[model samples]
Target: MSDQRESIRSNAKYLRNVRPIDPEEICEYVAGNPHPAVVRQQLREEAADLRLIEQDDGTFVPADDEPVSPRRGPVERFPAEYERRLEDLLVERYGPNWEDGASGDLLRSTVRRFKADYLDGRPVEYNDDVAAGYAIYHLPGYYAAIQYALDDLADRGLLDRTLRVLDLGAGVGGPALGLCDYLPDDALLEYHAVEPSAAADVLKDLLAETGRNTHPTIHRTTAEAFDPSEAVSGDGSSDGFDPTAPDDGFDLVLACNVLSELDDPVDVMQSYLETLAPKGTFLAMAPADKNTSVQLREVERELEEERLWDRDAVDFETSAAGDAERYRRGEVTVYGPTVRLWPGETPSDRGWSFDVRPDLDVPAVQRRLDENAPDDGEHAPGEFVNVDVQFSYSQLRLDGRRRIDMALETNEWAKMAEMERHVTERIDLVAAKLSRSLSGGDGNGGRGSGRSNPLFKISDGSEDTDHYAVVTTETALNRPLLEAGYGDVCSFEGILALWNDDEEAYNLVVDEETIVDRIT
Candidate 1:
């Protein structure tokens, strides 16, 4: 485990030169402590050089040498002052934890990590937050439900063997891949995914590497715009699709974790459901809330009208608060969130209460906070202070090995941009040291010297793997092997390793292990 940790750190150091400059870094490089006059001159030069290409292709390509390209989007060329204001706002909210101490290296490292795992490639989390989310969220069960639903449809021959499937809101393409794995080879399983996040890039990489039948046309675009009808003539190869023709649609349509964002989910479903062939099965997973209930009701109404409504209970509720209170009162923490414990195969037996806050909007909450600002740590009358957090819980159940892969999505790029400064600084410092070392002095000196590597670099970089430590006479699982600041990777093998290894010899620390083999 120590060797593996060292290896990851060494690799990080070696790849310092290969790190890409983040948008924030590019801004900083040009803004470089300039006087008012120099700043004006630079801004003038930038404006004089601006050029936009109006190409037939939808892509807005910028001039290659332009420092401030408008093609990436207006946000891409934000002024230095704007960035400063944004940083100040982040500091106010997240405190000093905002930028990892103003070093762009942290942001660069984050980007590099994202690129390495989820960006330009399939997110192969050896162990990380991406995986942990899957573990905690019980994503595997959702995949299982998809498979089961599809199998039920397939068994009845509802979808012909040649049917192609499109998975919407596929977080890491779990359901699409799982369905493919479960179906027979001759099923003609064509998989298409609709994801909106910049992580769509990651999904594409995964699709390419996994040897799956993926149509680039089937990626990145939203379902709203993915229709064949909307496709323009001469817009790339129809790629087995007719631009003017209605789709044969899909055999199975999987929509998970997507409907909640819509104000009119019913309309969205109605629009997309048309893409499914007649007698086609649509498996939808919502947050299991009132909003979800409304959407389900819409689906139910539509189904009943078509006489295809078949429902089953896939989840139950267990109150984490209720369980915590019981534990605090000197009772066993039972009847809490329906999580499977250790080798236990059953979910918790408890009813759950749903708390819906449709009235609370982000802007409204921010405004309220500003209006009722705490004066010297004292709350004003009628001030909105959250003494306790309110959370809604729903227990989802299914059967299968969970596929967990977590990578920082595109929305987090700005946050990661802040961390990039730290990473760049550290890299500069390391390079300086190396330069000095090669020169005359103590064999270590370059530009910025004597700085420690980022916390993540020091830690093992396995996001989809597990790390174990020896405890007493047994190897115990380090519940969360990685720190919160770092990435997390959880797996079934980690669970089994903890269960079987009550031994002392192999108690040191284990990074990764296969649990199925050990358990079986």
Candidate 2:
């Protein structure tokens, strides 16, 4: 398991580099400090230098240099001063937890309730007090999630079309800050923010006081209350901003952490889409909480069912010009409890959450913790804070501009895997039965979810055939086999590996922290 973990990390490091990415993909070749200024310079230079040609379909493909440029990652972070300002706000709220127990507890409780309300899909009515508390306690995370969301788009070249934008529920300017961090230093950008919370004011001031290079118009309005028809276009022309007037429109609309709180997400989403320009973009992001995760899936389904959107996954591979993996990707990373513990074959019950490790100002955070601790303490915030931060984000190009490669119709058989992997990519697979006699224990593979069974075989096809396949121990695919009274087919998807046992025989294995269903 330790060996496999290392392998996965190495693959991730490779993806940070070698993936053939577009020159406009923000910070695609950056690594190390992940400073915004350095990233900004690289983004501009690469875009200008890209010799890629445009296909008749209007999509730009790698010409000669391979749009897939090398990038060093650990994703770009918000500007350092932003973190300083965040820490200062936290310090002021409670004098750096000067009151100790009271302030910390209050902030924690507010965050919990905020998450719960978000999952419950309420009207998102947070007064100034709760909103402020949320900003102070959770802004760092929001900033992290927003950065990841942008990184995903940037990796896919989704940010190039962006110019005029609207940020729904733009709390403390997390997404706005992310945009400024990636867009070229001199890029002409017009931003409009719509939020009900007075925190909108904080977001406006954060952009101004913290020195956001871009100009943004912050509107204190709810997602439902805000009207795109009243929005002003990027150019001085009034028509582009007003969807009703319809000359041109904003390039991107980002609704981060707002959907889970919306009263009517479907209607709200449609309205947001209505505000886009011809080739505009829309992104929705939420925390890794189970219910919010569920909400994002529901929204994805609704978009497709209505035929208003075509879904696509991120691509990671090397290709030039018009050639890239239709959905270039490699394997999946497993997490959480191992073993098949569920009585019913249900992966959703395991509860997957967003895992992110944002580059936080640890010293500043530790200093705050130290101020609350007894004088005799030597604290290591890095120990506790390096843990993965997770969030779910979904993006869509407008109906008219949607990519043809993205399936117009959804695959019914893969629905379970799709919902389970709402945030991450998984290699689709179907579990083929091995001789039952080879199995020793009842559903308990004994090994954790990461352990795959040697006896069970894996195949990618619908029919049971060993024409071309690998053996897997992935308990995620095994649960369905465990549940059925008698069946030969189950589903599985995860990071794939080929290992040689003591005898030196190669065996294929897929890790399982997740449980998948077998409709067959």
TM-score of each: 0.32, 0.54
**Clash count, candidate 1:** 42
Q: Give the per-residue lDDT of model 1 (tens digit) for 1-520.
A: 2333233223323333454212222233342433434323222222211211112322112222311111111111112332243334334543554333432223323434543443242433322233222321222334333443343234334445344566666665445544554544323345567766544543443344332222223465665656633321122323355311234545456676555544565566555555555334456654433344335434433332332111121233468655321211111111111122222222111111112111212222223333434354543443332221112222111112111112333332111112223221211000000000111212121112333321111111111111122212122332233221111122223322221133111111223331211110
Query: For residues 300-360, could you state the per-residue lDDT of candidate 2 as single tens digits?
Result: 5465334332223445466666545553221111111111112223232222223334455
Show where candidate 1 strays beyond 4 Å: 1-139, 209-217, 230-236, 239-247, 287-294, 302-520
- Model 2 ranges off by over 4 Å: 1-71, 76-78, 87-125, 209-213, 233-240, 244-247, 307-388, 399-520
Query: Evaluated with TM-score, which candidate comes out highest?
Result: 2
Question: By lDDT, who's the top model here?
Answer: 2
What is the lDDT for 518 in model 2?
Answer: 59
